[model samples]
Every structure is written in structure tokens, then in C-alpha cells.
Target: MKKHNFYAGPSILSEYTIKNTADAVLNFAGTGLSLLEVSHRGKEFVAVNDEARALVKELLDVPETHEVIFLGGGASLQFYMIPFNLMKKKASYLDTGTWASNAIKEAKFVGEVDVVASSADKNYTYIPKNYTIAPDSEYFHITTNNTIYGTELHKIPEVNIPLVADMSSDIFSFPVDFSKYNAVYAGAQKNLAPAGVTIIIVRKDALGHVDRPLPTMLDYRTHIKKDSMFNTPPVLPIFSALQTLKWYKEQGGIKVLQKKNQEKAAVLYDEIDRNKLFRGTVAVEDRSLMNVCFVMNDEYKELEDKFADFAKAAGMIGIKGHRSVGGFRASLYNAMPIESVKALVQTMQEFEKKH
Candidate 1:
């Protein structure tokens, strides 16, 4: 049997997507050409690109004004590209955690960055509120979910300027009003596909407005005009993303997935609250549905290693917390089955009983 997967990124993918991608690797769509050998510009692969792009728009209900394009670099590149393209003089950023702070770091290279708010004071355990966005700032940036800290922004900030968001870890896992964001970028590893592709959705009108001339490749208009084919795309991962998108539609879209995700997070969170040995780390109101983090109780901290070994021996995988935050992190991505979550809960209970 396969072990339960709880790693943060390059994480779990739907078994259905995996099987189809494997079949494509053997012979894509019965074209007698392996997916690996096929030209990205070929008709068969072009269809793959078209369908994946369409599915993203359909899944997100993105408006006609927004152009969805797949790019080579992960969200890290977008962290810089966003500011490079949009920030002429100044920008605003919300500091949430590791990724968010890195995004802030990138924006600093392009222009003056005004940190609107930050949760660093509390070790990023909670989302900061009551921060003011600078009216003169070119755009406001936010990371919707702090994967490392297990905190999420339940609400989107309303502002007159463009609202750019990095939804790398939470996109498609929950329902979002796509229009509220002038631009959105997400790496496929978390809830979409493998690590090769990053999805970028930007309002068409929002581009070509910055004063600085962006490089041809970094320009959003270039990818949009070429239909994300300025260069060879990560065909296999895009195909895999299409399969995942198909599975998502068959499963009744994001609204339905949101309910299922909530249920899955509830199960583990409830267990974390009930179990005598473990307790959640993030604030109750800001806990992430995608990455549920918990730590051993203060009195039982010595047993953390033992419990980790116990879970590992019981077929659990990738539950180790990050270096900065020492605890267990169970990443419940979109493709993670409810049964797997239950298995983790059961393991936690069984370990608690033994302790």
C-alpha cells in the first residue's frame, strides 16, 4: 500500500492524473509518439496546452479581462517578475512567512517596497490585520497562505490599486473570487501539478502600464500574445495539470473541493485538539486548511522524536516540520484523499493511546 503523503510541495498528485500521465509517457493520446519525444509545438501538444489553459479559466471563472498563462519558473520567479513589470517607483507587501518574505525581498530589487503589515513579531503564527495600504503605492502584494507557518488569510484586502497575490499553496484547494485579484500566480506543485509549471493570471489591461521596459521574456504580454508558447512549455506537467483539472471538474469544481478540504482539515484539526499529546501551533482563526501544523504538548515535547518514528513506521510520510518551526506539518493538498487524512488521524490517536 502507498504511504500517506503530507509533504508541502512536489506533493501528492491524483492517482488518476498519474496513470494518464504515465500512459501519455508511453504513447500520448494514441499518437504513436511518447510524450517525451513529441514536439511542444506539434498539434497534439498544442491541444494539451489549449485545454489546460481553458480549464484553468473555467475552474477559476476568470473574467475575459484576465489572461491565464503558464510559465517555466516557479512562484519564486513571479515574486520578482511581478514587481519588475508593475512596480515603477513603489509597491506594498504583506509579510506572512518564508515565501512572503522572499517575495518582499525580490520586490525590493525592483523598487521601493513599503511593508504594509507583518506577522513576524509573533513568529508568523497569526495573520496581521489593521494595516494600511499606501494609496500612492503602484500595487499591493500578498501571499494568500503561509505554508511554512500554517496560517492563512481568510479575507482579501480591498484596495483601489492592483492586488497581486501568490496563491501557490492554496489555489484550487478553496473557493476564491478571482476578480478581486488583478494578478495571481501559483506554482503547480501544491494543488495543481508537478514542479515544472507556474500558473499566472493577470488582467490584460494591467500590463504595459509600468514605465520601465520589461525584457521580452519577462513581459506578460509576450506570453499572452503567443498563448504561453514563446518557448517550449513543460508539456508533461501541463498535461498532468489538465488531468487534475478534469478530475477537479468531475469532482464538482472548487466549491465542492472547498467543502471536502474543510472536512479533511476539520478531521485532523479536531484530532489535534482532542489528542492529549499534540496541540495546534497556529492561531485558531488563522489555521491553514492546506497545511495543518501541530506540535507535541509542552509536557510531552520529549516524545516528539518517538512519535515521529512511530508515524513513520506506521506508513506516514513527510510530516516533519520546517527547520525554523519545529513540529509536525501535515500538508493536505487538493489531491490528498480523505482516507489518507483519516489514516493520519488514526495514527495520531494510536500514538497518543500508547503514550
Candidate 2:
């Protein structure tokens, strides 16, 4: 049976990206040397690196003021790196979910953190609004999408200070105003590439102002100076990212994909709302397009596992929600076919009938 992938991430990738990367593993660019064995600085991989960076700039429409870099650590590293280079005396953050809370913890080590707004009061099922950021704060940080709670800050707040965001699970899934942010970073696993490599886009002027010394490795300038070659980059994921970027552009770019993502989220969410057995966890306005979170209605909560098994038996893979939040999450990333969402909706419908 064909499995419908809803694993969040390291989640589903486009079949094209997967197949191409697999082929490159055997023989990259017809060089007979596997991508795994090639020298990162060699002319072949150099081109790969160059094209990957170029594609990022091109796809994001990143301005000339910003530099895009591929780094080895997942976005977890960026939590500190962001504060390391940007936080001088203080930084502001929005506490929306687990990752955002983690980012807040990391930034506090660097400077004072003002959690301007939070939905943690509600177990993070909603986005906090009408909060104020300190103009005196060094910078403001936000996690654009919360994977755990299934809430999204779909409308980025207008902050006068330098805005930094962790877009780990949602970057490239939609069109964003590149000009508004001083920095944006993401782990490639979700909507970009694979489990390795984190993509960072930093406005050049935002650095060197933090007034403290950053370790050579932790410093953003080091990576920028070396063109992300200050050390061996995650070569496989970078190449695979290039493949995905190429595929994204060929499929009519992010604006096109954003519409599809919205439609896909709508399908599953419609079922969650219409069906008697399940209900969405997040506020309807704040529901995540990438991670649609829901659960069995309170009256039918005991059947959650049975529904999970039923869906799994019907070829749904990885629909389980995060352990902390007991429910279900269907991740609708760029590569997920609408058919998979339809199947999930159908499975939910069938389960409702069975119960």
C-alpha cells in the first residue's frame, strides 16, 4: 500500500529531490565519484555550493543587502547564534510554542529577554497579539510557525526594531517579504531540503554592531567571509536543497506553492471541523498551513489511538502529534500531494462512520 506521509519533518520531500539526490550519491554530475566522497572545495562541489546559494537568493528574492549561508548545525544552533551576534543588551521574543520557548532560553544567556507576548497561557493553542516590543531592545525574534502547537503567525507583526525569525518548518513554503527581516533561518528538513544543513539569510549591516566577541565558529561573519566554507558544509543536504530549489522554481515558485498549501490545509481541517469525532486544536484563524493539528473530540478522546491505527492501516504514515501535545498533526509541506490530504480526509470520514 502507498503510504501518505504526514511526518511533519524530516518529512516528505519531493520525489524529484529524492530521486536526484539518490542518483548523485552514486555519481554526482557524471563525475563517477559519489557525492558523499567528493571534496567540498573541489571545482564540482564548489559549483554546487555556488548554485545553492544563488538559488536561495533567487527564490527568496533576497535583497543585495542580505547574504545567504548554509551552515552545518540545524536551527538549534541558530538560537544562540542569533543572540550571539545580534543581542547586545536585550532582545524581545514571542513565545508561541516549544521551539520559540527554546529560542527564548538561548537568547537569555546572551542578554535580557523580554517575552513581549505569549500564548503559553493557553498551552500555546493561539497566537498572542497586541504585544509591544521595546524599541530599546537590541532586536525582536519570532518563530513564524509553531510545529508543536500548530499555530502560525501568518501575519508578521510590524516591528520597528531588527526582526529575526526562526522559520525552521515554514520557510520557502510561502512568499515572504524578504525586506522586512534582518535575519531569517530554517532547518532544511521541513520545507527546504533534508535533515542536515540550516539555511540562514542575514542582512549584512545587522552584524558587527553587537559589541562583543563571538567565537570564530559562532560568528556569522566568519561563515559569510568564507562563503559558508569556513568549514565543511553539509554537502549532501546542500546538493539536495539545490535540487528542491530547482524543483520549486520550475513548479512556479513560492507564491504558487503557497496557494496549494492553503488548499491542502483546508481539506484536512474541513474534515476535522465537519466530522463528529475530531476538532482542531488551534484557533481557526491561527491554524498552521504546514502542520494542521487536531484531535478526537473530547467525548471521543479515547478513540484517538484507534483512529491512528485505522489511518495507519489505511496507508497514513506519521500522523501522530508531538508527545507533549496529545493529538494528531498532518504536515502539509510543499511536496505533499493534495491526494494524500484527500486520502487523510477520507480516512477520517471512514473512521467517523465506523465509530
Candidate 3:
């Protein structure tokens, strides 16, 4: 049976991205050499790097004030790098979930991290509101989407301090006001490409203000100056990202994808709300469009494992929730076709009938 992919990271990829990347892997750019063997310094790979950066800028409408760079480390590295490069006196953070908590942890090692607001009191089920940003804060950090908890910050927080966001799970899912942020970083695994590369779009003038010395590799300036060639980047994932970006543009950019993603989320969420067997995990207002998380209702909780097996048997893969939070999570990334979402809903419905 054909499978519907719902895996979170290293998840679904467009057929266009997959097919083009496969061809390139075998014979890249008609150069008679596989992309795997191509040298980063060579013109062929250099062009790939250049085009990938350009497409990101174009699709995101990234201002000329910012420079986009593809680097090797995941967003996990960026948790430290953000403070290493930006923190002067202290930083402010809004802790919503696991990733945000991790970011706060890393920033503390760099300097003081004032957690202005947090929803950890409620187990991170809702976004904290009406929080104050410290005026002395060097920058404010937030994770736009909580993949594990399935809560998304739909509105960009308005703050005077420079704003930095880790958009690892939800980047490029919709149009963004790029000028609002000093920096936006994400691991490629969720919405862009694979797991090896991380993309950083940093405002050009936001660097060199920090008093502490930054390691050469850790500094954003180092990568910006070298055009992300400070060291050999994650070549394969970068190439795959270029292919995905090309496909994105062909689909009329992120605005179009946002509508499609919304529709997909609505379809599944509606089922979760209407069906008697399951209930959504987070506050309805804060539910994630990219990761739809739900669990069996209290009375039907015993059937959770049976429904999971039923869904899997019906060709729905990766619907299992994260270990920390038990239940089901269907990740509807930019590349996921709506049909797969419907298939998941149907599987849920079929299982509900049996119970």
C-alpha cells in the first residue's frame, strides 16, 4: 500500500525535490560528476550555494539588510550561537516548549537570560501573553513553533529590543514580515530539506556589538564574510534545499503554501474536534498548523495504541506523538499533500467507529 508520510523532522519532501535531487546525485548539472563528489570550492557547487541563498531571500522577501547563510550545525548550535554573537548585557526569552527551553538554557551559559514569560506552568499548552521585554535586553528570543507540544506563536511579538526567532519547524510555511526580526534561524529538517544543514538569515549590521570574544566558527560574521564557506558546508543537504526552494517558487511562493497548509490543518483538526474518540492537546487558539497533535478522549484513552496500529496498517506513517507528550501528531509541513492529511483523518474516523 502507498504510504502517507507524517514524520516530523527529516519528514515529507516534495516529489519535485526528490526527483530532481536523485537525478543530480547521479549526474549533477550535466557535469558528468555526482553531486556527492563535487568540490565546494568548484564553480558547480558554488553556483548551487549561491542560488540556494538567493532563492531563500526571494521566497521569504528577506530584506537586503539581511544576509542568508547555510551552515552545518542544526538549530541546536544556534541556541548558543545566538547569544555568543548578540548578547551584550543580557537576553530575554519566552519559553513555550522543549526547543524554547533549550534555547533559554544555552543563552544562560552566554549571559543572563531573563525569562520574561513562560507557559511551562500549564505544561506549555498555551502561548504566554502580554509579557514585558526587558529594556536592557540585548535581544529577545522565541521559538515560533513548538513541534512537540503543538503550539505556535501566530503573531510576531512586538518588542523594541532586537528580535530573534528559531523558526525551525514553521519557516517558509507562510509569508513572513522579515524586517521584523534581526535574525531568524532554523534547522533544514522540518520544512526545508534534510537534517544536516541550518539556515540563518541575519541582519547585516546586527553583529560585532557584543563585548565578549566570539570563536571564529561560532561567529555569524565569519560565515557571512565567507558566504557560508567559512568551512565546507553540509553539501548534500544544501543541494537538496536548493531543489526544494525551486519547487517552492514554482508553487507560487510561500503565500500559496500557507493557504494549502491551513486547509490541511483544518481538515485534520475538524476531525479531531468532531470525532468522539479524540481531543486536541493544546489550546485551540494556539494550535500549530504544521504539527497537529491530538489524543484519545479520557474515556477512550485505552484504545490509543489500537488506533495507532490501525492508522499504521492503513498506511499512515509517523502519526505517533513525541515521548514527552503521548498521543498522535500529524505533521503537515509545506511539502505534505492535503490528500495525506485526509487519509489520516479517515484512518482516525475508521478507528473511532470500531471503538
My TM-score estimates for the predictions, one after another, are 0.98, 0.98, 0.99
The TM-score of candidate 3 is: 0.99
Q: Which TM-score value belongs to model 1?
A: 0.98
Give a tens-digit lDDT track for model 1, residues 52-76.
9999999989889899999988999
> Could you tell me which 10 consecutive residues in candidate 1 have the lowest summed lDDT?
173-182
Q: lDDT of each prediction vs. the true structure?
A: 0.91, 0.91, 0.92
Compute the lDDT of residue 142 as modeled in candidate 3.
Answer: 90
What ranges in model 2 sit over 4 Å off?
A: none
Task: Give the Å error, residue 156, model 3.
Answer: 1.1
